[model samples]
Target: MESVFTILVLLTTVGLSGFVTRVIALKLPLPLIQILLGCVLAWPGFSLHVTFDPEFFMMLFIPPLLFADAWRIPKREFFRQRGAILALALGLALVTVPVIGYSVHALIPAIPLSVAFALAAVLAPTDAVALSGIAGKGAIPSNLRHILEGEALMNDASGLVALRFAIAAAMTGVFSLRHAFLSFVMIAVGGLAIGAAIGWLSIVLSSWFKKRASDEDPAAGVIMMLLLPFAAYLSAERAGCSGILAAVAAGMMMNYQSLRADMSIVTRLRIRGTWGMIEFVFNGMTFILLGLQLPHIIGSALIAAEAQGYTHMVVLIGYVLLVLMMLHLLRFGWMWGLRWLARRRRQRNATDLAVSGWRPLIIMTLGGVRGAVTLAGALSLPILLPDGMPFPGREMAIFIASGTILCSLLVAIVGLPMVLHGVSGKEDGLAAEERYARIEAAQAAIRALAETHDQIKVGLDESATVRVADCFARVMDLYRRHLEVLGADQTADEMARLDDQVDIKLRTRGLQAQRAELLRLRRRQKINDETLNKLLAEIDLAEAALFTRSRTV
Candidate 1:
């Protein structure tokens, strides 16, 4: 009962945090707001405490969130930026683990080398979720954002794997480079293969069910979709593989399947809305949980530091700052080197490199903010070694991890805006693609209508055929006008665009009037509740479609 109550309280807080963020004058990011609310919940008066189980948290929160991100990321852009992503995700992890590992050991000799390596490994994965929250949506340039998102998706697995090996070494006091390398290769390959196979099977089964019962409710399909990430994560773990990468691979496979399948429109919309809510809630809960753990982590670490004859809290904070600075310098240097190599290979103008490189480098550096995953990894450190003694520096490591997360968020919160200020927003590059798609779709509709009309006219009487033809012509005319509005000629395009805008406004007003009348009918008991909802849903879907078209065109 207590566990259930704790969950209810957390959910209530998550919902209220959304409202508070909207009402408050500060305009703080939602994650930050949730974290603060969590801190308040941790007060003695509240006594709201939830145990942090790192493995369960990873299984519960990480898979679906990573899945959603992978599903939504632009596949072409992801592949295009694969080089940069791999450099940051894999190569940077390689560099950071050793460099930051040694740096941490040098700063705090009390922390063993293996433990320091573990800390550095956890810190290696940057949180794109936090980056998005702090930077605001579309605030970063499109290309840079894609690279960041890809890096975040891939590095979670790499960082966690590194942490695992470091932990093993710490517990047993033995390490082998060859064994680690072979294990990593097997884990990554097996994870991707398993996830893809499972994803493919789910897609095929769903398709079969749809065909077997064409009129079935979409709810079952949606439920299955919700379970795919968990299934992938669990399956990979059972196979001694990377569950993080498995979840990511599953999402990518689902994306591919979606392109191939002719899924129902209703199912597509339901899947989208369901996943959006899941991402929001899970992400909120993760951050809030971090906040809930903070006070305990900091207090315990401070006491431990005092015991060690380090009386000043500033010393610990200084360690966090030092770690953070090392991360920035290393990231900056790696990025600069990659660019220099690319320039030499491409023979690009030095002037172009000089003009355009620094801003993005800075943005990427600041955007490398630590988040929930780092905290989770830190907290997951073993409480006892093989000798049954307390694990060395566990408390300090957790404290430092928590501090780094907060400080990185603070840095990005302050630095990103100053960096991005006064930069003119670019027109969405995909607008042209959307317009072209709309035109092609409209043309296809017209062609289909004509073919159907020809087939229907053959079997009908003259008068019936005329009426049918008239109906078809009216529908076809709508498509024709859509095509005209998306015209290629400059002057005609401008005029048609204005005319299309007027048409949309008129349609929007008509929809509003219909909705008002429907509600009026329900109020006066002229229509039953069922009838009202049925009509209202239709009206809402229409409005949604119109709103989407307005935004794109």
Candidate 2:
């Protein structure tokens, strides 16, 4: 009982810290702060004896996080940037490993080339969580954001495969480029096939379930979406393929199909909220748990370095900083070269839209912040090699990887906003377009309502029809009056948007009144719990619809 209570308190504290991040993020980046807080809480004085198990950690965290990211991303746009994404995910990661490995071997003569390459592979995958945060709110260009997201997802697979090959070569003293290539292709393709199959199965099963269930069974739909990522990941892993790729592919497939499905608006809203909250909780838990593991890792690393006869821990720290510098240099050079090549290709092809400027290259370079994936890879390293000797440079690999993660994170947290300043967000243009469309949609809705008035009146009784007509008349009046205030030449989309906001405010006033009345009835005991809940639900649904409609503008 005491153990249970202690855990409850600890988790609550961690969750509360996550919530506090939202408020403090304006001053310090939420990701940096959360990680720092985690490290601090890992102190022995806290009596937190956390253990690190790589396989278990990956199984717990990777699937849902990747799925949420993929689900939210725009499928069509992501595929449009598929070329750039593939280059970064596969080509750039492949380049980074050898270059980083070469540098590591040069610095630390004790570490074998293969082991260093393993370290390189550990660092190869960009931390998806950090990338997502750095690109949060889409402060960077949309095209670059899409590439970063896609690269982060796919490179986890590529880097892991490379890690496997590096370890094999280290253990056996034999390496074959051809075998590695074939193996990578098999793993990637297999994962994709498995994931797509599972995704289609999920959709079919969901359709079958919905056919039998009543309209109120949104839980059934939400459960299906929640189960999909785990199914993709586990099945792929069981098949000896890449679980990360499986989860990502499954998410994309599900997202594409869900977009085309004729799902009810309420179910869609519920699923969005449900999945959104789940992702938020999962991210917070991952970082907080990562913090709990810091103490043991840092201590072991220092001991290992001490055994090497280093005078001060500063020597190990120096190696970490050097590795970090190498990573940044390699990343910048790769992105710049690729961007230049892309521009040359575009010019040769005579494309109308001029190629993107250097900002994307700079942003992508700066955005190479590492996060949970790097940590997982480093921790996942086998404690002993095939010959039973302590894994060569294993401690250094973990330490270097952790230091690189912090460096990348601090750089992103401090640098992203500076680079983003003075740059315009595309949100302005999108919001404007959305507003114009919403105005047209409202006009159409009003006309349709008028046309169906006769049928609506015939179906309803006297009092009900009168109330319905009064509501319809008011809504129509609002739209007509709002549009009359707009310009003739569409001079400003913002004008219509502001007017739409005004319409939302007017609708919200009624919702507020309904809410107050519902609460009052409950307080007076004039209604049973079920009756009060039903009335409150109707009001809640109305407000939700109104909120969604307003946001369309």
Candidate 3:
């Protein structure tokens, strides 16, 4: 194990996992697989010599992963399901900590209340990325997915905040109700404010840099965009605010502001590719880390059991599992009851409401698996308490936290697929939606083209109008062909070829507009050459948005 290279082994695992996932359609969750792999690596003869710094692990991995999730979740869905999201993020975490704390203290009497609470806090929330990948495989409703994702995204921050407060209490040997309450409020509010401010600044800075770029090197503006999230997060953290929230806010702000008109197709492609890779690697590594830690966590527990006077760690493990089961049951019961109430209310009011089915709600609750953040918080537990004594039950607490997380991951990865299967497998609704969107877009495009042609016919001289009308007819025919392609009236090959031609024509027209603007500005001397470049970039971004919308349709 010492002779073998660690990085090479981890990378090999990642590559193998991906291959297994794609080739065999391995139905198991990737994280579960990764954790299993780690356990195997750590077992007796094959013990892969690996060590991780707690702070480095948390700071390096958590921020980017959380930020990416936040960035992808839409504002509309986030707000719509905010109540549920908050319930899970803040409210549920508060409930979970105490429940786990009480259960742990009862089952393992030697573990101090403070240490138990700290461990409880660590296992409070599940990993969103894991849930999404698992739940997304099923034909769950998009709105339900949004709620789960949003909740997962926000709860991670909330869980970390709780963990910090619990750690503070454990270290200082004092817990103040007022102080803890205030601290929670301050961290959440301050983090939000700072995140927003940083995000806005990043947008402004990125926009300014983009405007200053030369035509010969459009890619120069890209570097500023890449730096924005990191700068925003680090700066906010330095200013005594939550870096996680700050990173999320910056990513969300960039998603809204920078994705607008003026973004080149090339830029959009680059941004998507960059973020996709970031998300993939981060998720992959997280799973691997969790897997690697499993053997260590179990080994530590076994060693500590003798000193702690606990003969059956398995009994304690079972108790932890029971607590988790109860929490999930509570979640399911709440979701089901709330939805039933909502349905009744809608019926009484004679109002139409889109009810998110129960399957997703159930899956969402079960999906909570503790991840790297939990491990980080657990590891960060102080070596000593305020009285100069070793932190009570530190090793036992770590074992329990790690065990609960592993158990949660196992349950989620295995159970989610089964849960998804029972959910409505109907893609008809989404297919219908896609069809409707395409028809509407096609009709709207036709009307716009018709309107433009009408204006041209009216403005032109009688002789030129005929020739122009002929050109207009050709454009109309092309538009009709587009509609046919969308309607699936055209062959797939023909549609593909025509779609390429349509994109080329659109790009050509955009270029023509830029040329026209440049010529007009040069003649008048009212606008500088720089203005043309800026305006053209803006136009390109706008065009790219339209293209993106079309593709989605």
Flag the better candidate by TM-score, 1 or 3: 1
Tell me each candidate's TM-score: 0.94, 0.90, 0.78
Q: List candidate 1 stretches off by more than 4 Å.
A: 305-311, 347-355, 424-429, 461-466, 488-491, 524-526
RMSD of 3: 8.4
lDDT of 1 by residue, 10-99 (tens): 999989988998899888888888889888888889979889999999999999999999999999888877888898999998789999
Give the per-residue lDDT of model 3 (tens digit) for 202-301: 6677678768766635455556665666776677668776777777777777677656797776777777778787777778777787777777777776
Per-residue lDDT value at 519 in model 1: 100
Cα displacement (Å) at residue 421, model 2? 1.3
In model 2, the Cα lDDT at residue 443 comes to 80
Worst 10 residues of 2 by lDDT: 346-355
Q: Candidate 2, residues 1-553: lDDT per residue as tens digits? A: 7668645755675577667767763766556656766777677687655566788878878898888888778786677677778878999899988999998999988788998999899898986576666546757766567678788888999998899899888888999999899989999999999988998888887778777876666886788788889989999999989888999889888886667556777688788889887877677667766666666678887787677676557877888889888887887777777767767776522221124676666678887778788888888777787778888888778888887887788878777888888765565656677669867876897788788776778877889999989987886776675565443546455676677788788878988998898889889998888988888888888888788767555
User: lDDT value for candidate 2?
Assistant: 0.78
Candidate 3 lDDT at 431 equals 77
lDDT of 3: 0.71
Candidate 3 ranges beyond 4 A from true positions: 1-9, 24-26, 40-48, 216-220, 305-311, 340-361, 386-388, 425-433, 447-478, 484-553
Candidate 1, after superposition: displacement of residue 534 in Å?
A: 2.6
Best by TM-score: 1
TM-score attained by model 3:
0.78
